[model samples]
Target: MPATAPDLDSRAAAVLGGGATHAARTYRPAIRVARARGSRKWLVDGRELVDYTMGHGALLLGHAPPEVVAAVRAQVEKGTHYGAASVVEVEWAERIVAAVDSVEQVRFTASGTEAAMLALRLARAATGRDRIAKFDGHFHGWYDAVSVELDGAGRPVPGAGVPASMAALTRVVRADDGDALATALSDQQVAAVVVEPSGAHYGRSPLQPGFMAEVRRRCDETGTLLVVDEVVTGFRVARGGMQELLGVRPDLSLFGKVMAGGLPGGAVGGRREVMELLSPADGHVVHPGTYNANPLTAAAGIATLDLIVDGEARAQADAYAERLEREWRCVLSDAGVAGRVWRLASIIHCALDDPDAQARLPGALRERGVDLLHTSGFCSTAHDERDLADTVAALAAAVRAAARVRR
Candidate 1:
């Protein structure tokens, strides 16, 4: 922590249990952001950094983009929360339904976690099954039912505070293991099979190209619902999302991040019949949130979606990410560092073959004025050639620093 940060560390420790709201933000020598614009963030102590975290994979248009900010500012005067339906919410849902092929109806939630939970519940209600299947290492959210990891025997193991009984309800299968997936769903006991279409951990471990199609096939064969968790990839990877890129239609899609235009909101959008279960007419399921489709988020979402519906922003961001991937590979090669840089759409994943390099890379890059989420980076439409050059140079320096430390 910088001395000039003015008690950010102590304030964080006092207020935030882990000295940070999110685990990823709890880096040693913590940085407190004072403000951000475009692809850069200025720390509280006045240190400027080229940011790649991009709101933990939100902000597809980049930090505080003028249009989104303008919409939010305009909506602030009207009201923040009405606790009732609004035209903005209806318009937001309309855009989502129009964009996503599988979504005929949509329901809003306060976060992706809630959206996912509701999607699963909807699945259970539709299928009359209690079990859900998921790919190993595929993160849906922090919710207990979806937070389990696979054990040595490929069984689901719950995270701390999550009951083993709840974990057992989730069947974990290996990603890309067609046979395991088939076997898991063969019993027809599962209500849904959920996955991140961008692969596990948002492309840290990328999925095979045709694996999702296979999932779709298996789901159809087993009469199981396929729930695509597109919280990070929705509207960021493509206008419609990874489902559009892959040409697979999920029964239910969980969306957030870009969908809310950098605001805090999420949605469960899918087949009308399944989503209609939440309707009070039948009263099949109860779903409500104080901030669900709040006017501010709705306005921001509409504005953001309007710009990206043409796919220009997404294409530009993807092109930028591709360039960064190529350039970073060259950077690692030139430095005699062993690392791999790969990308999916606007997201970039870097993995150093050396454990020491892997461990030190993020901190080293931060010191060199670049910030990434774990080993990944997200490009935005706001990221330009200058940002790319700065990021590559910073990464190269970080690689060299890690090598020196290893020596």
Candidate 2:
């Protein structure tokens, strides 16, 4: 191992922008992971961290799960990519269709960003409309069409390089504002209203209980297609995703993260008529990618889905998350930290009531050998009691550290 992360960080910065490929992984005192398995990862310097990033909410079974690894290993011998349709892709699609209630047909993409883009395209083709509506703070992806930030008045402010005209086409509304949502959809100009069903940024700011149902009702009333971006929640929250838990069906569903079983893959699954727009028979839409359904990703996805479809993995993860949430709250109380912990399925969000403490919490936890995504933590089936105990202890220490800084 190198003496410090600087050598690796320099090499990364030389090749990759900001010394990281992903914005989230660009943490200070940069950590370079060498390998990961189960609930932990080792840095290049051999420091072990009980991981809560969990592949950015992709690895519900944890890193390098044996079953998924075996599937990928076996498929490598046969072929990596065929650049054409394969049996594995067909089987993978079938699994998704069977599991997701709204998905009658499925089209694979390289990432969740691509899936969101395709969902919007399909909605437009099917509805003959050009505009789309999305919730503020509900991130779909980095694509220019959806990479919009809301202003004080809730109007969209386009990200750099995104044309103002394009941003204008996307109507932005607060997730919980039923009146605003109804008004936006009532115009009949929106092709689809997209949302992260698990609320903004995967439950960082939780949505009200009936918000989803309200969105669905408004979409139906206005004939606007409902597009649920389940890229993070699908298969992780339940076999059918947030839809399964909420009993609300969408016209189109965006799936990634857990859907690909830790591999880089995504899909747009939904009504047959809308999805058929991609079929070349009518030539209405053209969707193509070099790695649309690479055999390796397909094999891994198939194995992962098989385990999760039974709901065993999800149940275990949710239980662990509940325990962590309860224990975290208790730890905060015992430490006299002004904070609260909440959960949505296997995902947990922690907030120090104080803004300064909240800002410092994640870094403090990192210093104590625990890694979280911002102030939130994701629980995986592979995370055991020891991991939970360690996390609680680390969180308590971090809270105390933040309190010290506040003092």
**Distance from true location, Cα of 279 in model 2, Å:** 1.4
Candidate 2 displacement at residue 164 in angstroms? 1.2
| Candidate 1 residue lDDT tens string, 224-287 | 9999999998998877888998999999999999989989999999998898899887649888
RMSD of each: 1.8, 1.5
Candidates' C-alpha lDDT: 0.91, 0.90
lDDT of 2 by residue, 59-93 (tens): 99999999999999999999998867799999999
Cα-based lDDT at residue 343, candidate 1: 91
Q: What is the lDDT, from 0 to 100, of the residue 334 in candidate 1?
A: 89
Pairing residues by index, what is the TM-score of model 1? 0.97
Q: C-alpha displacement of 139 in model 1, angstroms?
A: 0.9
How well does candidate 2 score on lDDT at residue 122?
89
In model 1, what lDDT does residue 64 have? 90
